[model samples]
Target: MKRMLLMGIALLCISCQGIAQEKKEEKKQFPITKTDAEWKAELTNMQYYVLRRAGTERAFSSELLENKDKGTYVCAACETPLFKSKHKFRSGTGWPSFDREIKGNVAFDVDYNIGYARTEEHCATCGGHLGHVFDDGPKKTTGKRHCINGAALKFVPENE
Candidate 1:
């Protein structure tokens, strides 16, 4: 009977260890990670504030709002390709707006900074805060308005 009891306890311990291992595996680690000092050194003041601290840029302040060129928008922190020029549209929100992001390059989370839940978007590689997404977009496409901060992105012209 003692041997049987010992075996049962061992089985329970094994199951608990398996559960712990699964929980550890479920946590995500980004491909790009930098120390806070390194990030601050690499990014401009506004970029660091917006991307790392989740600060919003003033509306209509971004030159990207007026850009009509053919290019791709990359994460300012990690240079990960995020949005294409073709997906961009004038949301008139004064920020650079996109209809969609490059698949698997962006991650979404919930934000309640204003006392309501909103879908927040970030760069998948470095987990930099890009901006929030909304449903108010042109109905002809994906119906997602990925309203992004200009400071969080760097445009690469297609020719380059």
Candidate 2:
């Protein structure tokens, strides 16, 4: 009888842990929130896919990857400045790579979509999906590559 009681207590403890784990995944609040329809109406199809749905664009398909002009990369969803022109680099990874974000404008979360944990980036203002940041970057700089989707961003020239 004592063993049975102990087993029940152990099971209760295990179940409580599961509940705690589930709570960790609760929807996070962002500074800006919008309805799905509102987002669809505002963003183009590619922007909607990469930002709203967390879908990835095909490699080498972004026009912004080759942009050499000085500008700020802003979130497509909320126009929040995310990266500076100076931080951008030629990672040759077929995506627009930045050594660092503008800070405070970007947020992060861990995603295991492909069965491996990856550091996912997001627009802090609207929680729009941006891309993933990897540790493999220029050794001379931050040594972090922010492989962002061009569809998730808008270029704002400095003079503008």
| Candidate 1 stretches greater than 4 Å from native | 1-28
Candidate 1 similarity to native, TM-score: 0.82
> Candidates' TM-scores?
0.82, 0.86
Q: Pick the candidate with the highest TM-score.
A: 2
Worst 10 residues of 1 by lDDT: 18-27
The sequence of per-residue lDDT tens digits that candidate 2 reaches over residues 57-146 is 999999999999998999988999999998999999999999999879999999888978899999999999999999999999999999
Expressed as tens digits, the lDDT of each residue in 65-154 for candidate 1 is 899999999999999999999999999899999999999999998777897889999899999999999999989998889999999999
lDDT agreement of model 1 with the native: 0.93
Q: For each candidate, what is the lDDT?
A: 0.93, 0.94
**Pairs of residues clashing in candidate 2:** none
Task: Highest lDDT: give the candidate number.
Answer: 2
